[model samples]
Target: MAYNCIVLVKQVPDTANISGKTMKDDGTVNRAALPAIFNPEDLNALEMALRVREQHGGQVTVLTMGPPRAAEVLREALYRGADRVILLSDRKFAGSDTLATSYALKCAVERTGDYDLVFCGRQAIDGDTAQVGPQVAEKLGLPQITYAESIQALQGSEIVVQRAFPLGKETVKCTVPCLLTVVSSANRPRPPSARRMIAYKLAATSLECPALLKQWPEFETAEALDRYLAERDQKIPVWTAADIGADEEKLGLPGSPTKVLKIDYVVLETSESRQVPATPEGASGLVRELIQDHIV
Candidate 1:
């Protein structure tokens, strides 16, 4: 049976290179000062979902919650083989913590119904909470498999997967229509295909359509979009929040419950030491000293 899959991805600031100045005095991220990139583990999740589509005949839809600029990742997903991409962006979605974020995502997922499975990264590198997937599953009232290392088998409406545990690994089976949080080890995400990238380079999201129309009044109707898409070899479908019937209150910042309280910078001090080489007998004596010091 063909299984429809939805993958959730995120664009996050590169936190590894973060500095004190990266955070504002209000404890919010200085987004202007940071470069955005797709979350690493989320890419793995998308790869796993894409593999499912490859093995079983189905469409893979990618979803993300971010600003309008985040549409860049959706196009990137299309270039990487996603059948459809939806951008859940609104000014109200700003300053969302994990709880609010999941709520909005759950709404988006419901709007894109008819999927048998949902995949998400274990955690966002910037947030590092690892709570959105499970929270989304809870909101949707679906079975969840967290920290999935690999999908062993998918047959009919049942799926068998290997999950990673602290002490050891365990294989678990679950019914279809489940949510899964995947680790970076799940699979290697494929690089963007050159042809697809070139085709979709100027693709526009629904939010961007108006601006495009304002700039180029020549292409105004569905036919115009179709002709443009054909000539450009791109997929450009505009979907509004009204089309998705998303609740306005449950979508933006007002629907979210978590808030960033503070940002702190930490510094560490270390001492440096040098080791001296020793002759054979001196080495033996050093070994004896190490054994006595429990350092052997």
Candidate 2:
């Protein structure tokens, strides 16, 4: 049997470094100040799905929900060996929390049709809610396994996976058509293949406008684009909300029930003191002062 796997991924803002100017007065993230990268754990999930396809003859499709710029990650996925890629981008999807996000993703999955397995990262850096996978599974009525570290075995329609728990790990066997959330320990993502990079450098997805073709006459016709995409066999196919039969109300911001109540700046108190020494005695004195001031 030919297995089909779908991997859900996301692009998240780098939250480690936050500047005073990074937030708008309205409390929304100042996206301009933050660099965007694929959620690191999601790449681990993608690696796991790719390994499954390598072991079992099957195709791997990558799906992501983000803005038009999110297509960059889809291209990156192609370079990593995904057979196909889909971008679920729509204005309505903006400001959606996990609940609304999952709804949109489930609709996209339904539109994709036939698939035996679905994979997603344990959590996103931006939200860290880790609710989308389970929510999608609930919507699709599929069995869900979260925090999976590895695939212990796969026999026919049943798959044995090593799932990570707070206390330890457990192996669970589930049938096909199941959803799995993978932790970073699941697998290490491979670097993009040099050969594929050169070939699919300009592959077009549906999210791309016809204007791109006009701007670059080389990909003017579908036939020309096809030839170019075939050269590397690493191009990601794009899809629109309509292509996926997504419910208008259930997509984008209008369909979302969650809202960002408030955003505020957190400032930490600082002191100007010169350390007398770098020795343990100096450290002890600093610790004493911190304890006295309740700043430790």
Candidate 3:
């Protein structure tokens, strides 16, 4: 029997290139200032799902919840090996904390029909709380294995995974229909297929049709373009909160209980840096300085 898998992925702001405008006064990230890229760890999760499909003969569906621009990641997934990609984009999902985000994801997962495995990255860089995946598991009432480093084996109705802990490693066996929060150590994700990339380059979600039409200009209407893309199975799905049967009260900021009381932006200066000659004494001095500064 084929084991169907669903991979939850995200497109996050490239925090490494953060600028002065990266944070707004409201304490939320000003994503407009940063280029978006596929979340690194989520790519590991996707690779794990694809590997499972390759081994067990099943389909991999990728799902993400973000704005219309988030379809870029969905298209990237198609260029990889995902059989289907769905975008959960609705205005109501804005400003959602981990609790609210997991709630929406739980509903989306339920809507995707039956699946033998669910995969998610351990955490998103923008919010390194590492809460969403396990929260999703709790919301779905599914057993979860987090910090998963690698899949060990799959027995009848069960799966074994090697996971990492603070000081050691562990191998856990979980039943099917379970969620696995993968870490970056799981596997090296495959690059996009050149053939699939060419085939799916024009894939677009309905909300993206207007921009596509502007770029292509061959299509007279967005609806016509949508139909054309859909015919070729290149149209990424866009689902709203109502589409997934999510309660409005539990959908977004309203459902998010975590409040950001304050956000302080710190700017490092050259004076903060200390240098010493490259020697054993220098290393000892550095360790002493770290200890004195309470940074070690």
Question: What lDDT does the true structure give each of the candidates?
Answer: 0.83, 0.83, 0.91
Off by over 4 Å in 3: 19-33, 267-296
Worst 10 residues of 2 by lDDT: 204-213
How many residue pairs clash per model?
2, 3, 0
Which candidate has the top score in lDDT? 3
Error of 3 at 133 (Å): 0.4
Query: Considering only N, C-alpha and C atoms within 3 Å, which residue pairs clash in candidate 3?
Result: none
The digit string of per-residue lDDT tens for model 3 on 219-238 reads 99999999999999888999
Please give the ranking of all candidate structures by lDDT, highest first, separated by commas: 3, 2, 1
Model 3: lowest-lDDT 10 consecutive positions: 265-274
Model 1 local distance difference test score: 0.83
Candidate 1 TM-score over all chains jointly: 0.77
Query: 1-296 in candidate 2: lDDT tens per residue?
Result: 66889999998888867776888775566889999888988899899989989988799989998888898888888889888888887776777778778988898888877999999999989879999999999999999999999999887899999998779999999998899999988777999998878767776564464545677786667656655655655345656667777777776677777776886555444688584689999888989988999997
Cα lDDT of candidate 3 equals: 0.91
Q: Which 10 consecutive positions of candidate 1 have the poorest summed lDDT?
A: 233-242
